[model samples]
Target: MGHRFPAIVVLGWVLAAAALSLLVTPLGTVVERSSTAFLPEDSPTLQGLRVMDTAFGSGDTQSYVFVVITDDDGLGDGERRVYADLVSTLEDEPERVSEVQDYLGQPQARRSMTSKDGQATYLVVGLRSAVGSPASDEDVKWLRSAVEDLDAPPGTEVHVTGDPAMISDLTTAVNEASLKITAVSLFLLVGILWLVYRRVTTVLVSLVTIGVALLCTRGALAWAGEQGLALSTYTDAFVVAITLGAGTDYCVFLISRFREEYGNGLEPLDAVAEAVSRGGVRCSV
Candidate 1:
């Protein structure tokens, strides 16, 4: 039984890790290709613009808005110089960019640029690519840096806003948050087990068993994936929670019975065997 438990734990952990890797690899591919991760491919209103295309053709294109801040006095000589510099930069990149409308240069575009107090100027740049196109990131980075490079009038600020970049940033933040949560939960669970058992060996054994159970569960998921199952991103968390909780519960039952037998003067090995028999019967029922 002792040898069996350790072997079971090792095999389970290895299988779980393999299964998780398999499931995650395919899921990552799907997320990137299907436009379901950082940016979606299809728009409800626009017919042809996919999230994957950075260049816009016959369909509606993705837009990036640069908000330039200045004093309420409006575009003075210094402000005009800044605007000219930005315009020249945009004009030089005609191949990558379609149109650049600055409030200071294009009076018609000024309607959209004017803030409530007229302290800020907004520039709308149209890209040649569609929403999720590779060119979109480059365009956004170029525009933001260009505005920042400009010698703005005193107290001026520049900020870039758009859906594509924002969504990409959101995905990064969510992944980080999920990782932190998982790490904290694992630490807390280990601490709780240690406190409940007060024996290093007991706690370690419990963790090993639970770990094996988790591996088995993940292996099951991986097999499902191989059979063409569509797993969600949240499936990992669900499987981990169910496996760990159930496995730990089983460990506690076994350990409790073992302790009871030991108190009655049974040898350690005999107590463990008796505990396993009792725990196994109860668990199976």
Candidate 2:
């Protein structure tokens, strides 16, 4: 009974961790994927990118701005020809280009918002995929090349920016950071436990308990996924923190009581039994 107390506490911790993760992670994923009443929808710029993901069956999208040089005073013949040719070229690549709306020619909102001097025009281009898509890099490269090839009046510059690429980059960075933090936290925890106990065996036992709890939590996440749950990146960290803290706390209580009895000259086995009897009662309460 004494030896089993720690195991039972660890198992309970595992079960609790698994339950919490299963309940919360999927909800987080859904919130991230769709807007709720409390949270506003993605901005129009972001919506455009999402539309590309829907249209192309790819999880990528981009928003681009193409600027062209016009006469110093206003729109000129040279600028008109350059703009027309740019539109024609973009139209030729329909698959790569999802939509192109030129302020110069389209009936878009706030037409007056285009550069009043007419020296530069804005063309909003939406890509059908995000940066992670197989053809995204190629698409960006082609856009750059096309912009370079354009016979603009002069001083024209093309700029591209959007939510899909930014979000993907941010997500990757966050994942790396989370992994580093988890690794460091685990190492520090074990080191602290070993230092406090000054016994390799005790430290190992505690670590094993933690490991079991983690596995249980991860298994729950996997099961959630199988049930069509979309987990967010934070779920793993939440599970790890909860499981480790609770498992280690339970193990510490049992181990401390056992050590106290052993110090009082009781046999190792007797001390373990007493520790379990007391710890089990406390844990149940």
Candidate 3:
């Protein structure tokens, strides 16, 4: 096999890597952390929610991002006006906001929505989508950007916090952490392989092959997802660990054997063949 079509062998791995790279975004979409994901379809809770949804048109609880407006000497004119303007802005942009519970003007609800000192009051902004949904994530991003540049009193602060916001934040955090961990793991693998092999070709080849293998595995998993395979959010993290660890171990075994065969005065191609027949088979099994 080594004597026949070496270029095809290398090109196959390269093309696999490219295909996986293209599927990365679609793969991310398939990993859902929604409340509905964990609930069984026939469960009482799911059935109840479905019934409620049919009755009320939306069983999903309205996600409320509390916008607290405050000042040093209690709610002043500027603070009140800012709160009103915020409510007006949300109301004007019907597409972005589903509802804005203007607790700012409702004196009856002041006790429940305001701080004990009367300096702080909050507005509950209802989201258009349920938490963990794609629509909910888009709304969260829009809400964040909308409030980011709001004109308010000198000391008045704005924050968007709710289930939707939290879910979006959690997803972003997990993705970032996974990438960082994967990078560190690969870096350490390369360093260790370099020290052990004492040859650039061996280290580079092993690492590149391992990377290609990992990409191929992930791409296959992504394709499964496309075909209605439901996977947990932790799938990506686990795949990264398993593929890298197993690939490195197998590559090391094969490379060590090849080195041994070459030291015995065998040619490069012959050494590879012998290494595959010995170490590669054991690694595979």
RMSD to truth, every model? 6.9, 8.9, 4.9
Model 2 is weakest, by summed lDDT over 10 consecutive residues, at 31-40
| Candidate 3 lDDT by residue in tens digits, 39-97 | 34577764764675557543343344667677767877887777777888888867656
How do all models score by TM-score? 0.56, 0.50, 0.71
The prediction achieving the highest lDDT against the true structure is: 3
Please give, for residues 1-285, the per-residue lDDT of candidate 1 as tens digits: 353365674666666666675555543343333322223445553333434233433223454444455666755577667767777888698766666767655577766766667666656666665444345545666777777888776765666676645544555465566677667767877888888988888888887777766666666665565556655444555566667667767887888898899999998767777787776552211
TM-score of 1: 0.56
Model 2 per-residue lDDT tens digits across residues 1-285: 325465675567767766765654443343234212211236664576468657763353354434434455666676667767777888798788766766556457425545765555556666754443324545656776887898765554444444434444455575577678778878887888887898898899888777866766676665665566655445555666677777778788888998899999998877877786787553221
lDDT (0 to 1) per candidate: 0.62, 0.62, 0.73
**Candidates 1 and 2, the one with greater TM-score:** 1
Q: Count the backbone clashes (under 3 Å) in each candidate.
A: 12, 4, 0
Cα-based lDDT at residue 18, candidate 3 = 88
Residue range with the least summed lDDT across 10 consecutive positions in model 1 = 30-39
Candidate 3 or 1, higher TM-score = 3
* lDDT score at residue 189, model 3, on the 0-100 scale: 95
Model 3 regions lying over 4 Å from their true place? 1-11, 19-62, 230-242, 253-285
